[model samples]
Target: MTAPSGTTPNPLEALRAKLAAEPAVVDAAAPVVDAATLEDDYIVCHCTNVTAGELRGLIHEAGCSSLEEIQRCTRAGGSCGKCVPLLTEVVSIELGRAGIA
Candidate 1:
């Protein structure tokens, strides 16, 4: 493509060259969430002050079979909507372990 025969120069290539000269950027390390053991994962919800351990305990103590049951007993999903999925996952794992699935 001859740029209609009269354009002096292309601008895209110049912009690309400028960007290529910049230093490489690095990302900061993120904290790990275990999601397996009850002690390592971060439970952002604190209404129940429920840690992963306490959630596991609730499953055993209340015989919670579903996410709603766990939520009702511990208020894990009562406050914020963020941690509900995680709590559900943990409860599922606990129920599976207890042969209740």
Candidate 2:
């Protein structure tokens, strides 16, 4: 079946497109933490051995703005899916720290 007009081929792609189109309104006064400088040693997903640093890399470098995208890129929450919550938190923290929102 064909996708609806103006809609992306898939939800994930749609999300990625939307995120890419968004204007990053960073507060000039707020301190922006470089993703590379983030010292993320804690492992968020043990099933995949995905550390917080790795996930941050996906966000900062790979431009993954959502948890699903991160999972697709790194298989972090793809195993038992138990670490989805923590992964979500990590994504939020990294995004905020990086001043993406």
Candidate 3:
């Protein structure tokens, strides 16, 4: 797309405008909840009823390294897929603790 007349459109300005149009989409200062701080019993994938402890067992005992391996073993994020991010975070925490992240 060409800019109007001789004026140049700043890409950053367009990006900022687009982002601003979306309400409460992002909080730059908000802290991310740490997956490591959650208890082992905490449900990381509600769809599969998989807990943090199970993920840890997969990572530490079973030596599962990736989310795909975990999914194949336990079917955590197979349905709906909403819990995938939390599952990933839990996996990341477990892998990080095991020095594999």
How far off is residue 60 in model 2, in Å? 1.9
lDDT of each: 0.66, 0.74, 0.82
41 Cα displacement, candidate 2 (Å): 2.3
Top-scoring candidate (TM-score)? 3
- Which lDDT tens digits does candidate 2 get at residues 1-101? 34689975787777777888886786543334433354678677889988888888888887887777778888887888767767777788888877774
Q: Write the residue-wise lDDT of candidate 3 on 3-69 in tens digits.
A: 6988998898887887788757665333356777878898877788998889999999999988889
Find the 10 residues in a row with the least total lDDT in model 3: 25-34
Model 3 error, position 91 (Å): 0.6
**1 versus 2: better lDDT goes to:** 2
TM-score to native of every candidate shown: 0.57, 0.55, 0.65
What lDDT score goes with residue 1 in model 1?
21
Tell me how many clashing residue pairs each candidate has.
Answer: 0, 0, 0
Off by over 4 Å in 3: 1-33
For model 1, state the Cα shift of residue 11 in Å.
Answer: 26
